[model samples]
Target: MIDLAPHDETDTTALKERERFAQILVLFGRHGLKGLAARLGLGAGGGEPLEDTRPEAIVALLRDIGPVAVKFGQILAMRSDLLEPAWVDALSKLQDRVPPLPFAAVQPLIEEAIGGPIETSFSHFETEALAAGSIAQAHAATLLDGRDVIVKIRRPGIERIVDADLRLLRRLARVAERRIPEIARLKPDELLRHFAESLAREMDLSAEARASDAIGEYLKTYGVRTARFDWELSGRRVNIQERLRGFPASDLDAARRSDLDLATLASTYAQAILRMIIINGHFHADPHPGNVFFLEDGTLGLIDFGAVGTLLPRRREELVRLGLAIASEDTGGVVDILMLWAGDPDVERVRLEEAMAELIDRFSNVLLDQIDLADIFQMVFAILRDFHLALPPDLALVLRTLLTAEGFVRRIDPAFDIARELAPIAKELMRERASPARLRGEAGKLLAALGRAVLSTPNLVGQIEKVARTGSITVSIAPKDLERLRGRERAGRGTPQLYPATLAICAAIVFSSQPLLAGLLAFGAVALAVFEGVRRR
Candidate 1:
């Protein structure tokens, strides 16, 4: 188990650290730092900042803080659930461009991990790094057999810095859980822990190499064009992969100059992303333009597979159901999925229904030719956030990556219709649901479960009747069960207060006879009544 104790207060640099943290918060606010600071407990009275240059401020702040901060900004950029489109666009520019560690610092790490000196393993190894990033730097090297490859070396002691930051974050998450009642339902601490695990995996070069190989195998199985790594040359601190020479995905001018079909490229990417999620159940979690490349023949090369998301077979089925429900514009189906996925199943259904309706109306009715993938994804994200429906961690990352991929596609071709391409894939998934084999398997499982329950019903009824007669009974309740029950009770209690208050406000507004006020109140009254009814049920 991970110990989440607070850091010891024994640093001589305490004053400097505190001052730097304060400055960081201030800068974060400049990027809409006010809102970010408020989330971090640095704001007052819930008031807006006097000056707001959120976009430029955020860009400048990210540029100043180096890789980790820039990486954080990139994560935030993918969060259409937490931020607006304009901010997402600005934050997308937070590229991984740290200065490479000196060759002196890297050579030793490679030698230690590979159990040999650089000279023993390679015929030629460049002393200069080809590229640098937050966790590792890469150098061009030629193997003993003369095969060209890139050797990625993890920076020594970087893990300590990451661990310290994560430790502090976990502590802050605990404080938020205790003090910020409004956000408790979101499970910020759990989310941070999930991110911490992902970051930890990224710090291990061997783990990244493994992930790359796994994803590459999946891609090959699906007949998709993707790059693979040489795992034999990988170790704890070093990853060696075949190097490809191609222009980055963001270089649209270069692609146009090279006779690449922008629309076809966009469609290929969208289809690849959908297949990764629905069929393979695994995907690269970060698909920004910088990590993608386009070769002259138009084969897309995906690199940097450090961050990834995977869904269990069951979760994949549920996700397919959710996607189909959205495609069919079934608000009830969407609400059911949202409730099933939420920590609290007893959440206000009316609110969820309203959000779902808004989402379906916005996304489902848009003309296929006119639909923008980024906008559609943002709408879906907004609905999830408005209803406080937290997605499972891995699924959330996949969704964010999809949104980023959509943004990249849009940048490549303004007229590219991602949704139109995705619609067919969604339909195909729905068709798969109706396959005879799948249906039979589902039916057989249901029948078996029902048969068992029916066979045991007499004894169950007898026990219940005995308990009812004796006025005593026992029921086993696990810790998770208890938490779920408490969550339901809290939601139930909160429902009534909102309704009566809303009714009173509506009555007052009707008495005043202000048309706009009356309309607003009427809407609120209807919403409250629905909420109350759903809660009672």
Candidate 2:
């Protein structure tokens, strides 16, 4: 086990830590998680440690910890590589459903953020909240120019609350890493850093506004409808945007009542999402029923831009390669793509190839129309998990977004096949990959890498020569390996001591008349013990 070294104490730090600890303890007690608390060495005054980490307990813990923690859990839910399926399923249900703060409580903050009181900020502002979440509440309003909009007000004092909780979470992550051996591979610190950055971006309304504008522009280019954010009225804590009124995607009955064509809507929405991922390489990470709406004019409107994912050019290219390779049933191509995309060199090639072959064989016999894209993707992810390969954060989020989209679209039309839809996109991507411009770019990159390698060859060779001459080399082992080595050494020591002592005692009994044999056995025992002590030293 690793040590969780304590931080230096100060008046303010101590107070904040104490408050955070107390809140955690209380929440743990409320959720009957005293056992978990005890396991973290935060024993609930007088309680036993919980030996098992059940899925339900994890959900309860995150729920009671508050919004940021809840959000963290939701994000973690997508990380199948880091968690069991049951844990992921439980955490995926986290929602930001906190009760709305009273309008009076948020009014002052909104006025200050928007540079005026409600009377001057807008032509008409409602006191009642239209929607509420853990971080902010939305109210219906009308702009001075007579445009209907929604004003989202950040909860009073939320910034401090979230910030403090984040600090506590960082400390807790550290503790978890040290105390829980299994979690080290998950790199809790790095995961927390990513979570913190994502949360920070979410807290800034301007950032969300910028993301919305970028995504809106891209989607509009493809004739996909999206809401536009009014930057003039947006601030750090207040977001003003065009008010969207329509049947939520989840309301199937409402859609039918409006005589909406479910088939067309399903196809259009699926195509738009595919374009967002494969063509534009930027997408809304969360496209759940709650965030999607169908306008009266048949346009699909997506809201809640706080969570988004972007795919880099190379990563996008790799995904295209992966799809095409899978279609061809080429195990080597799949393996190459995994190595390049995930950047994990330690994966066992034979095992990965065998897994990919099995996956290909299973899917190859099925017709395109019969294949389920989401199931295929899940199988691929399962292979990666088995090999201890983890996708980059952006890729993981994009995959989850695609999976969610597939599920949502399929709900509208049971016969909808994402695989059939994706086939053409994959082929197009392959064609693009082989295009003159792309080939030239790839060739240039290859040459540059080769040039660097050639220039550094002599220096690399010199280092190897120097190391050989000095006979100096060091090997670093993982904690798990080191622990095993220690265990073997301990067992080896005990056997030597026991065997020699046993032999001496047996000799003393059997050779009582033979003084020489008895003496030899006793001497051997003493010698073996001394040799063992020296080896230990």
Candidate 3:
């Protein structure tokens, strides 16, 4: 029997929820941030606020709260753009090291997953756990055919616990966001969503196995290795993969102690990361040193596939445009991209453009080699915060991955320059972009969008005709504009089919394969269609 001072006390009607709510409140009050707790209506006491102090206390509080909080902290650590340096530094030190459960506790679960006693698949399984985290545990074992592998098993009932905790966190984040301006500005709710998505994927061992297969195979060209999952024995809760022999990427001393070409390894690591993001659009979201291993056979071994991010083709193009715009100080292009990400429609464009100019000035003539990417991006985010703009979740993940990848590689060799390596990749990408194949692809995309725009037009026409006959929807327009819109309709009625027919012909070659073009064409195409509609008003 416990009581907590949470704001929505009346809603905790469920007996288990009330207990967990009280537990969370108790942990909050015990761990500092009394002011934050009070502000969120979860505590009776008040003290310094979340922004005022206690990075260490916050880290301790997260660890105490459990794995979900640690996972959230891990995300926050990668977000130096949105968090204070002290908080970032503190949270980065929170490791996912937890005491392992007895082998007996997980044996039944494994036996069920493998469809028989462990002896059927594994020749020799270690009774002692190799590693344990909040969601899963691992054990060293030999397969029936005598190959070494790591058997990872999800902790029994962890799914239900994680789901309940996530729901609680969502409510807490929403409450905190509404009550605290600092928390609102930090976008706690959005961060929580990102964390929850990744956590769910992490818990799904099958999804992780697939990611390992894709990313591992892709990295082979760059001298990187990935553990291959034993698919026949893998399931949603259990997965076994070949054991990789390597030292952790963080073990710089171990790396130096070996005769490997550290610089070459560092370059390949950075290059692979960029290619995945820039070219392939799928990437390991967290390439932190801890998740990477320098293997015995001169290849980097990457692990932990629970979280990945994707940038669609258009997003990749926008990123490239943004980079070129920043490099060339193209204020209009920069603002155009920023407006897409502005959280509020009322954001002042003139002010935003002026702010962009100042940011550009900071790096005006500096060589790319001399620029500190992390500093530039941090400043950009700070300005976006000032302007009430939020980075799209995918782009934020990209930035975090870039920062982590850079840091990971730089740790291996201090003199390694990612920007320097990127110049060549950039050139190669340019060549690919200009290739005849790319030109044909781009052309095909345009005509397919044209077909979609034309295909969706009849719906707009039906609405217009319905309004004309029944006035079911309200219409607003200037009288003179209305007259002009009417005037063009009668004048253009005979000429409408020329382009539509041409579009039909061109789109036959393109639109058949564009079935998944879910949204309307890009904004420019939408604007053209809207302009046409308005002209016929």
Best by lDDT: 3
Return the TM-score for each candidate structure: 0.73, 0.80, 0.78
Deviation of model 3 at 249, angstroms: 2.1
Residues 1-537 of candidate 2 have per-residue lDDT tens digits of 222233556667666677678777788777777766765667634434333667787788888888889988988998876666777788988888888888889888888877787778689989989889888899999978898898888787888889988878887888767766666556778788888888888888777788888888987765556667788668889888888778789888788788777778787777778888878888888888778898888878888888888887767767766766687776666777777656656655656777888989987788777877778877887787777777777787888888898889878888886666776776787688789998897667655655655575686456434544554543467875465445445434223435665755555554536667766775565556554443222
Clashes of 1: 4
Question: What count of clashes does model 3 give?
Answer: 0
Report RMSD for candidate 2. 15.5
**lDDT, candidate 1, 1-537, per-residue tens:** 122342456764454455556666676665656654564465644534423445767677767755555666666666666555678788988877788878998788888866788888799999998888888898999888878788998888888767655555556567657655544655767667777777778888777777777777767543345555666668777888877677888776788888777777777776777778767788888787877888656677788888888877877776776766687776666676776666555555655666777768866666777866667676777777666677777667877777777778778777877557767776777687789987887667655655655576687557534544565555576876566446446445332435645553454435434646655664455555544433322
> What TM-score number comes out for model 2?
0.80
- Shift in Å, residue 479, candidate 3: 20
Task: Score each candidate by Cα lDDT.
Answer: 0.69, 0.75, 0.77
- lDDT for model 1 comes to 0.69
- lDDT for model 3, please: 0.77
Ranking by lDDT: 3, 2, 1
Candidate 1, residue 437: Cα displacement in angstroms equals: 3.1
Provide C-alpha RMSD values for all models, in order: 12.1, 15.5, 9.8
